[model samples]
Target chain A: MKRNSTWKTVHRYGVYNKSTGAKVSLTGGFGYDYTDGSTATRGFISPNGAWFDNPTVAFTAAAPTKAVTAQNEAKTPYTLSWAPGKLSKKVAVVEALKASGPNFFTAWVDNGGEVDVRITNNGGTYEAKYYTMGTSTQIANPFTASVGDDSSSPIIASEITSNKWLGWMHSPEKRTQIYWAGGASISFYQETNMSADATLLGKTNGAGNTGYTTLYAVENRAIADATKFPVEAATWVASTTDAYEYGRVNASADVRFYFTALNPPAGKLARTLYLDVNPAGPDAGDKAIMFNFSANERSKEYTSFAATPVTATLNKTGSNLRISNGHTSPWSLGIQRWQVLLTPHFTSGALVRLGGTTQ
Target chain B: MIALKADGTVYAMSEPMVLNYVHAASKDMNENKEIVFVKEDGNNHNPVPALCTAPTASRHYPGGTTDVVVCSVEPSDFGTKTYKLRYNGKWVNGLPDMEGRNSENDKNGFRVTMVNPKAGTVVTHTVGGVTTNYVLKPLAVAEAFLPESNAALCNDINFTTVAQFGWSMSDLPSATMIPTAIPNLGQSAGTSKFEVLGRQWRRISLSIRAFS
Candidate 1:
């Protein structure tokens, strides 16, 4: 192949395999010089024979082949139609098999008989053969899921040291900021390496309102597109308000809560794991403040509040937690405090549990 | 052509084929052949305790076997490893050319085989009326190797093979299902399939060896 040999510019060359009669297109517009021996073999253009009368079609020698070992089908390397290359442009889902030697090889499997076979001799001998596996299943990948930490919030980068490390910071709405490291309050969120202006993954209510006080990560079974998959996580926040003529209704009846990727696309649901938090409610009788956490529409009702701390634990798989509370009578004007420490252990039960004192 | 970012810094636009050529040039089969140091866990039901234990010194290889098998124990600390081999019924005490790309010998053959078979899955390969079961345990650091480390566990040592596999898009829509381009920038350019270029870059650097 010579550049401008016919006195006209050629942008691309379609290399035709003389043996199998398959066309492999190459993109080389100019400044490419091909000699008699410097052609590629095995699915590539080999120009050993007659020169190309037409500028676009380059005549090549017959490419070599390898004997197919049907039992070794598990190991053969091939290109899927989606990967970038000639195969990507094809309409049919064609798999182009590859064999590696000192030089790379490409082979097409158009019919049912063409099975991709790879053979290598350690002594660096270059030999090629082709065989047919007439009756066999197509190659398959074991796992489709691209697994990673799809955390609900932007991970506080400094808090990450090991795998599965969970970072928590109070939403910017809170005047008193907090960060959790190993379930311990490490420092104020603004003081840490994480910038105060950095945006969280999901929306957070502004200052003076009930916002996301806590956010944690959960593992999903499979994510179809890693680039677009939402982080599987939940946010919880508590609020305190003033009482009116009704007396001691100081705390609000609701807790701010949000779930990331709650309703994913069909057939791509995030694996549902249940959350059970103690001292939770949607009560109306005696409780003053009602904290309702809703997931899977499952509700837990607690009638009264004790000095005991608020706690969260994992229930059985494929379930959700919904906690709500109600206020019937009025009480004192003091603020109720809740500090929850959530720790996630990735094990059989797969529960994300939190513990903290309520006062 | 080059474009400048909002920060006024120069942006480098490279041809996709240049990346492919760079990847092809960087291909090396021996890249995976390295000593992975590990910290042995005591609770691991190691089938071959002798081979799995921390090696104070190199061990000897027994005679007449056509192949020598080596396995690196899991939980390695990151550098220390066993680098022992044998030749002609004698201990060579180092790694040799098991793949034999350069050296081919009648007696000496070495291989380090790491298998991630399902836990408790026993793989059996039989030859010459002798049957061997590869008992894969859950997080078992190293299973079986040459000269029969444990007779109670399987001693069969002929397990050296490597095959080149490819990337598969099981969940993505087929090429025929996707349109060539979208009408609007947000709808077409933001399509999931179009996002594969960035993801493919990660996949190529992480897993793909050059075709050669």
Candidate 2:
């Protein structure tokens, strides 16, 4: 019951970044210090699964378990997982479950006495409990088949973006190449930001010609070891691939995809939301949020946003901003709710303030 | 693994090489998960003359027993899959096949034969595992596996909680058998037994969860 000692003073603007202002060198390790860089509660290491700033193993300590209710239908899954820090907040979620790839998680079920019972406070002051049904264990991945890289063909990077954003991952070592797999040509990195020849990186791929694409970041180390009971999705790519050559298996084909953006520019806070704030509505932050998005708007863009008031702002001159959706789709923008998961507890307020660095 | 033929004979896994079998990729998973070995029309079935990468092997598909499943066995696109049978002191790739990993409806795919005379196959893949060598009896020639063989429709595999209880979105249910991965097939009634001597082949199919 001790308070987290690593927590710095609450910020009016946003969370702290490894570098100053909203800039990442993009050279060495991308100077990005996590909100919970290295501490017990917010730290990433755990006896179970080390999830310092790991998103898959992160948990939220909100009541009514508000975090669970925040789930909205997604083109991409939540890609979550269990990351215990010797101690965690969410009661029932013993092992962190992934929201992507082969790691599976359905709604509640009955235990029939054979399973274990877990309890939590469903936002109510008192704690709540849940009885998991049918025993469960993690399984192997779906992309066991070796897929030859699009060899003998160099595709225009722009052609890769003209379609539905199929999920992607990056393999470590020298084998650095983008792939468009699935039924059709799945799009990868939208605006290849870097000039050509700037080799890319992402989750490393495995041995079966299936190395990691650039769409995901590994939150832990042990998630890749293939020997375990088969239940770890730490290495899954959370983007959808529209181009399935075997053709799609229908809605039931166990195919799921994901897409992620670079961590918000250090010192800069970005929020992805399902709902937008009405320009003429009651003070912003009054409306509740749903999903997350990672789009950057520009040139004459008009968008309204609402942020909740903590201590209450004094002068409110349109706390919301207007930005262009540009060429991106805000279909399920809810990244704001996603924070650097602190093994046991995931905190949302970890982001830095808008336009301004943490004072 | 050793494949049990219908005639109650134990077909040794003579070879142990993975074969790549691929089907059309579609949107609806339940309907597209089928793999059948059918003929164009009245053709009995045009069997592959020899089923091994190394032409040195004198036998294959009709050589003895083969286990086939509907999956991404194409070694070119994906990687070479393992299709082996048990024989002699060491487990060989001549016997039958393994289970199909694709979980859905391959009610209309086909099963072919493959072999690898090469010793060091792709890592993590081979023809067969362990073998007993005891030949039981011979199996009937199932003309149903040839490309020209009648496209025998497989209509019994089922999934989903709404379709059948217990399988939630994350259910990892799997099946392993000589004929079908799902018990919803014709052999579940225990009609088919083990067989050793056979011109055609037998198959073992298993369906596991690819993702949640």
Candidate 3:
């Protein structure tokens, strides 16, 4: 199972009312991922010098059973089926989410969060799939059934069965594109590891299937059908002045994609998506580090934020940041080594080491 | 010049310099170069910016409690900086100088942004037509009923009241009974002069009644 390396999170503590079983005296502390590896393996030694395994808890699956069903579809042992047209298929999937029960997923529906119905030929022929954006947990249906066998007329399937439900996270093996609906909401990213010796999307002939090359497609609203489909290189828009922005992360190039979507749903605040891409390829002697910062404190987001480098002068205030280090797979920690005191509070002899892809 | 790369790495744009601070008071070398001293030597130094300061002890409010800790960081060539409170583990940043005239702006001092996640709320306070937004964490109802001594455990926006009065449950002589003998109760009794004191006492009583 993939380890939980959440960059930003909150830990709430409170007293419970014994009679009503209700929470009282609720208090919480905000926490960031400070360590590199799973505390289980890295462990920890207390001030007394007694070593013990880091405290860990099972990943409580988010409620509204459908959310779990949808996430399961994106993992291993599941292949995403494609649909001919995504319009009607999206409606059926939304209906299933609405009926699934009241959870953050349903809250998104109540807020009129836009649902994008994807009907691309993602590794195979199947029906349309739609995923809700801006929810605590994003849910999508990569159904198993295929329809419109005949090319003359396409059939729009309306049935969204439990077996067909899958999560929005796409399988990387298929070299599929993951769309991040950019807005005020926090971006939930499942760790995607690109191995050094592993085969990438590009082919040996110096040509790459655009499907495999373009890994992340970020936009707040729907894109033109012409630009989104046929999985071609020309379809990915790269203009800085455009309403949307995307990155084709070549291994050697350090590219920054700046996106600000002005037109957001009412009550939704549009934000700037700053993605500093460093792909794990042959560059840097086989290691890469990717940095993504999109939200600010007002949004109460977890993923990434503006990163200020540790300076020798100590002029700028060091922010509480979550930096994912390592260019290799399982992107653990301790890739680059340098020590800088984060604040004046540090003792004269104390040194805090910062890890990074480059320094 | 030390420049920050896109991936948050510090690189030498010019000749590399040691990241150390020389304290002016004692002329001692601070190896880490992070802590800013009130006085620094003539050499170029990085000092922590003192944006705002909060009380170390909890500041009791009408309905809640809050404590503040002051931290400093040296200003960098980079624009605005962000910080996380070690006490609460919450991220805070300085607000932009919207008026471009007030001391609360980046030029004078920074305005700290606070967020209360549970309420998903932001409260903007405007004074003299200058507006600043701050998130107010929800104060539990139980806090409004705490004995004044124990009430200083909650958190809220900073405010000061000119007049303050507090009477604890311990102030009363008996917890279960009301005194029967004219209740001497620290006040003059049964005279025209006492009538004036009684009126003043009644007003204090009403204010306390409205508070609870």
Task: Kindly report, for each predicted structure in the order presented, the TM-score of its chain A compared with the true chain A.
Answer: 0.13, 0.17, 0.17
Per-residue CA lDDT of model 3 for A206-302, tens digit only, reads 2222112212222222121222221211121122322121222223222322111222122211211222233332222211112222212222222
lDDT of 2 by residue, A1-359 (tens): 11111111110111112233321111110111233334322222111122223332223212100011111243211122211101111211212212222211122222222211122222222111222221222111112222211222212233224532222322111112223332222222211111001111121233311211111111321111112111111111122221111111222211111111112112211111111123221223222211111112222311122222122111112211112323332211212121111122222222111110000
For each candidate, what TM-score against the reference?
0.14, 0.16, 0.18
TM-score of chain B of 2: 0.16
Q: Model 2: residues >4 Å from true position, as ranges?
A: A1-61, A64-359, B1-212
The positional error of residue A9 in candidate 1, measured at the CA in angstroms, is 48
Note the DockQ of each predicted structure.
0.01, 0.01, 0.01
Given the true complex, what DockQ would model 1 score? 0.01
Error of 1 at A20 (Å): 33
Q: What is the lDDT of residue A211 in candidate 1?
A: 21
Q: Which model, 2 or 3, shows the larger lDDT? A: 3
Query: Which lDDT tens digits does candidate 1 get at residues A170-220?
Result: 221122223333221234321111101112111134332112122222222
TM-score of chain A of 2: 0.17
The weakest ten consecutive residues by lDDT in model 3 chain A span A84-93
lDDT of 1 by residue, B42-145 (tens): 31222132333343223323332233233343212112211211111111112211121111122343233221223333223233445444322232223221
The digit string of per-residue lDDT tens for model 2 on B3-112 reads: 11233222222221222211122211112222332222211112211111212233223332323322322212212212222222212223222322121233343333
Interface RMSD of 3: 23.9
Q: Report the CAPRI category for model 2.
A: incorrect
